[model samples]
Target: MASSSAGIVTGLVAAAFVTIGVLAHQASVTAPADLGPAHATVSPAPGAVKAPRDRRHPDALPAGSGTGERVVYSVDDDRVWLVGPGNKVRHTFAVTPGSVDPAPGAYTVTSRSSRITGSDGVLVEHVVRFTSAGGVAVGFSAAVDDAAAKPDPDRPTGGIRESRADGDAMWEFATIGRPVVVVR
Candidate 1:
């Protein structure tokens, strides 16, 4: 009877290990090629309908940011805009982008952390993560100490740094499943 019980326990443990392995494999297959295994499960969707943008101004919210409440990040401008209802601009600010930029498309906010150590080893707060790029988790965060400095070019990171005030606004505005649009 003792030997039979031991065999049953061993079988359960082996089954659990096999299940874990299968799950890990599935996850790897679904992740984007550039994002690696740590990427959020939600892949970036097609680009939003673009509105005509004014090439002259870098500050006025770029055209084609999409209507309704959304967070828009411009890879070229290094700017962020928190848009509200009726396509009104609630807040606009500059940001220090990370080494890797997500492609120009639409993604939903996948997760958030109030305070945590960033991939660059800096203490950060109000981390609003939307997508992954270049084998790293891409998100917006403010340095806990308010530094909001530029990231090291040598490191492959996706942390878009923002001011503390801006981080606060982003934390409040961008919740899970919120639309995040990446423009030029």
Candidate 2:
């Protein structure tokens, strides 16, 4: 009887191991492919409407008091917006929320850069970096609560290198050198 019991236990342990191995194999077999590289050619479904225009602007006050703030920006649905005081809009151009995927939500501007000219005369423009606060939703049910610039430990630079880091994920955006004005 003792030998029989030991054999049963051994059989059960072996079965458990086999089951785990099968599950692992199945998981590996069913794993999805990385589709990021091939996503460029994919087009949106027919009749699917794009997201509404971003009307948000920076928080800067209008040039003249009581004149209703005028926001400068270029309209690009692909980018995010920072709504200024009196509903003035400022286009950050390239900076977008880290959580933006298939569908993105509103993001608030966390930092801004002053106008800077590049040595190439290309006019390296100012950038407005933003992070996801609450109430902003996006695709894949992901959201960002905070973001900051990536600090280079090797070289301590003065200007903040804009970056978005939500937990382990991070993203960066380049600023376009154009401004448009909108009155609220």
Candidate 3:
């Protein structure tokens, strides 16, 4: 009888471990709530309309923006997400894109200027440049006068304008060599 009792105890312990393992696996495979059905849809055909943003969580970091510390800029949404370790979104904000948009791809911060005259002739601060399009240097900046208006369409410009506070955050987060992911 004691032997039978020991066997039953061992069986229960084994079952518990199996159950725990299954649960952990499920959790690891499951997408984060904000990601929504994204990982599976990362590589849609070229020129395919990008997935619609989650209306419920518009500020959620876009899916397929890659993992780890990086900046994600969505051209369609005209928004930026500062992603940190563990794929968490540290901050997100709307931006005003210029006439040229960077092609959807990964890039690293190539340079930054604390204060400079933007291509559009706006006195800007915290200029964080990552890529260029059509000879225009693409970057994020805030106008010294706090202007965040749309850029003039006639001129080719690449400044993705942000608010002063947002520019400060970008300046601090996007150091040189930090990954910047552009998505449609």
Candidate 4:
């Protein structure tokens, strides 16, 4: 009876390990290539009407942004807005800011990465690097598991996180050298 119980326990442990391995494998499958953010924008299905745009935040713009097209980021609100020609808002979304905030100024999107291990050791996607502060690159990314948990206060965090869907929109909207306006 003792030997049989031990065998059962061993089998259960093995099964748990196998289950963990399978989950890990699935999680490791990276997001699709960064064909710029347009790849994720899907058309409405048959017989389905498109949803109306959200004009709730009409005055969401900060005071310092340019009147021309640009990406506007509000450090106080931790929100980003992609402005189009004539100062039209193309897309807007909230973001998980880092421990450090970039000063209120104009910056350009310097680089982008489809996938990368964030400074916090998280597997991130849709990395859009905008500026460097205190030797750390500040950018936006989504976790592999699509988690948007707040950053750890103890760690030196520089990755401004967003949902996978939002990150995709940002990745598509902001390209290399795209203007970024930071406001308080």
Instruction: Pick the TM-score winner.
Output: 3
- Worst lDDT run of 10 residues, candidate 4, spans 35-44
Worst 10 residues of 2 by lDDT: 34-43
lDDT of 1 by residue, 23-110 (tens): 9997666423221223232223356233346777757887656677889888777889999998888999999988877777677899
- Report the C-alpha lDDT of model 2 over 1-184, residue by residue, as the tens digit: 9999999999999999999999999767621221111111112234533333334633333222122222222112323333345655433333322222221111223444444432212222243433222322211001122233332434322222222221112122222321222211
In model 1, the clashing pairs are: 51-64
What C-alpha lDDT values do all the predictions have?
A: 0.81, 0.30, 0.82, 0.72
lDDT of 2: 0.30
Per-prediction backbone clash count: 1, 12, 0, 1
lDDT of 4 at 165: 90
For model 1 the TM-score comes to 0.71
Error of 1 at 30 (Å): 16
User: In model 4, where do residues sit more than 4 Å from their true spots?
Assistant: 1-59
- Best candidate, lDDT: 3
- Across 1-184, the per-residue lDDT of candidate 4 in tens digits comes to 9999999999999999999999999878652231111111111123522222236854466543666777887666778888998778888888888776665556678899999889888899989988877666877788988876577777766788889998999888889988776665
* lDDT at residue 59 of model 3 (Cα atoms): 85
lDDT winner between candidates 1 and 2: 1
